[model samples]
Target chain A: MGVNIKNLSILIAAVALAGAWVGQGQADNEVVFPMPTGPLYVKECGSCHTAYAPGLLPARSWQKMMNELDNHFGEDASLDEPDRLAILRMLTDHAADNPNANMLMRRVAASIPRGAAPQRITETQLFRFQHDEVPAHIWKRAKIGSKANCGACHTRANEGRYPEREVRIPR
Target chain B: MMRLLALLFVMTTPAWATTPQQILDSLVQEARQTQSGFTASVSRGEQFYRAKQTGGKEADSCASCHTDNPKAEGRHIKTHKAIEALAPSANKQRFTDPAQVEKWFRRNCREVLGRVCTPQEKADFTAYVLSVK
Candidate 1:
């Protein structure tokens, strides 16, 4: 039994090393690119959530959001003419159509269903679809107050939308 | 030795990597939780399943249209195409993973459950699903 355990341990270590090597390879030529930095998307976008998953919408959608800054989620997540222009320039430069968006952005765009209709931040089908799953008692937990209070579980709301792994629903 | 057991424990937990049962419980729980901010209400998952749309060209709960697997023969009442069931693996083209699980909890909880879900309802519904097989 002792010999078997030792052999198994060695085998596990070898497999772990191999897995790490493969994981490193998967992190290939992906470049660390930045979003077009014109205004203050970090501060401005947080009104709803962070600047949204850039890939959440197409380049056209981002333009629409930026254009209608006055009515952004009923707020003004916009910048001044100079600031807005710089932001726009930055956005357009790094638009979903642009190659600079990260692989995550590009992957999200590709995953969108072919017939999916154009969706806003609030009116998205996926958003609607997901909200349907939660039960009520889960929310009444002393820790949670409201549905829109995404920050209850999603620690990253102040930073942006919930990352899948980051959400830890209250017990 | 303790670390090994801890790792094994996490790996075996259903919540970490959910199955169909866990998903269903989460749904049921969301329906039962009490929330103040909802635009609507749903006390039962079945009731939620039978809800009706408001201010639209037609009115029906999700069950009104998606009676069966959409890919088979269930067609949309409006579009006249095959209706799609909410099954994740069934519609890989739609929900790739559990991340969408939380996403829907937020979106559908409002649409059908009429609010955010409670964790208890999630557990019950998840239990209900485990019993399916």
Candidate 2:
């Protein structure tokens, strides 16, 4: 009986060791998406404006942005083929549908319901609410209120992303 | 010097010091307490975007006709083009009232997750969608 108890303890220790190894291995394989804007994000658009964040949309939105580059908001933000392909790959992979993604992303894709008419789009709801907090003087600025100007205040914009700190409204 | 130190201490405090996960949990619990047909299951945001109606009657989810790939053939209800990826400013008309946001949560949650969304789930979900560029 004494020998059997000792063996059992040894086996338990081995199992725990195996579990730790497996857990560590799993953590390493985890795929984190919409990695912070890379050099291209900064190099390309950052010259004129701040880069937009990748987590801004699921793959679909990125695809749309890529396709419309030829006529991007009256501006030609098109990329060199290699850069375009790379950015698209990154954005789509990090899209909002990914359930295993970070907590901030999961919430965005989950569902926030936009009401009937007057507001059928989700972004509108955000701006409507977000704008409420901003002073009207900011919106009426020399080149503001385009809505795409979200990066105006969300500074990380030019680097292909937006961060809260970049939001310095023109007085 | 003491006043400056006191000001520094106040500034250093975290605004909410809350993890996004905790916020999501709270929203999920809120959905449970409300019982307004909203679901509380938080799915992977990217999966949800590409998520086709797995067990639904028709292939007509925000993903389906919109196409599994949004860039190629997006046909979300309004956008005539291949679906424009979802964005807040892409369309402000998505929501008018706070309650309406809840309504869609209930309906879409059932459509997507096959259930209702909890408040924290919705909040988390909202954060993800809004985060998109």
Give the chain A TM-score for each candidate.
0.54, 0.57
> Ten consecutive residues with minimal summed lDDT in candidate 1 chain B?
B36-45
User: Which residue runs of candidate 2 sit more than 4 Å off their true CA positions?
Assistant: A1-37, A111-124, A143-145, A155-168, B1-133
For model 1 the local lDDT of residue A129 reads 59
**Interface RMSD values for all candidates:** 15.9, 13.5
Q: Each prediction's DockQ?
A: 0.01, 0.01
TM-score of each: 0.37, 0.37
Error of 1 at A36 (Å): 6.6
The digit string of per-residue lDDT tens for model 1 on A1-171 reads 567988999999999999998875554323222443433664344333434444445566667667887554443344557666666655566554466565645654565555553546445554555566778888666556445455567665544345556778878
CA lDDT, every prediction? 0.50, 0.50
**lDDT measured at residue B104 in model 2 versus the true structure, 0 to 100:** 46
> Cα lDDT for residue B34, model 2?
64
- Please give, for residues B1-133, the per-residue lDDT of candidate 2 as tens digits: 9999999986986544544345445565676676665544325544555555554333335565445433342442221212334444354433333433554455456555555554555664665554444
Instruction: Write model 2 residue lDDT over A18-132, tens digit each, in one string.
Output: 9999886554333222454456555443433334445545555667778876444433345668777887776666665554456445544444442321111226344355457
